[model samples]
Target: MSDLGNTFMRRFVQFINTADEKLGEELIAPNAEFYVPFQSEPLVGPRGWLKAVEVMRGGFPDVQWTLEELVVEGEKIAARYTMRGTHEGTFFGVPATGKKIAIQTMNFYAMANGKIVGERGQPDLLGLMQQIGAVPAPS
Candidate 1:
């Protein structure tokens, strides 16, 4: 992968795991859009991206996002990652369970002008919920 791809990957993961809104503004395009599973509507621009991070941080204050693999194809980047944290606050109406959760996530980021223009993510929501006791484990 090119340096641009690797660099953006680090910055993007840092922005999400740390709730760095400032970094979001720098790395994401002004009109960028993100299709994320957790939200009903698509996230627009850096501010909208930050909002999603805020919601996540509110529930997992110490969340850590680690990139396990990355592949770059022209202006698109595909990444496989993992997030680990303890549920310490309410999340989408679910109360804290003080459970440690590890969820796998995959993402495809589209870049333009050295900024992220769009992103689509798929995360292991079922596993995450089960870890936090929101969803029951299989029998």
Candidate 2:
């Protein structure tokens, strides 16, 4: 189970980095639930997940996520990632500032039948916003 979880998380990281719809469909269950920040409703399935990726890419065309660490147990996997990108387009109603950002993100996933069935993610949005000049950083 640990090996499977590890392999699944690797593929999941690939999907995130590439935003490949085909790969996403293969890794994510059709009815998977994703609990994300800011949004009130859970994003459902591969399409929903891909949409989120698209939004990120729209704002940061050179965005990339590196899987820094992973811990797997049974059907659960916890991952830590470093997300880096340049803000080159509008995001969350804020105009681009051509600033670079690197933020840490943590996510917990539940897998079934070798596919991701659920995910809860926590990303450093406040830091990201500050880096991109969307929000003021504290002195």
The most accurate candidate by lDDT is 2
Model 1 lDDT tens row, 47-103:
888877777788989888899999999998999999898899998678999999899
Pairs that collide in candidate 1 are none
lDDT of 1 at 104: 95
lDDT of 2: 0.90
lDDT of 2 at 110: 90
Could you give candidate 2's per-residue lDDT for residues 1-139 as a string of tens digits?
Answer: 7777677778888899888899999999999999889688999999989878888888999999988999998788899999999999998988988999999999999989888899999999999999998789999
Score residue 14 of candidate 2 by CA lDDT. 89
Off by over 4 Å in 1: none
Error of 2 at 4 (Å): 2.7
Candidate 1 all-Cα RMSD: 1.3
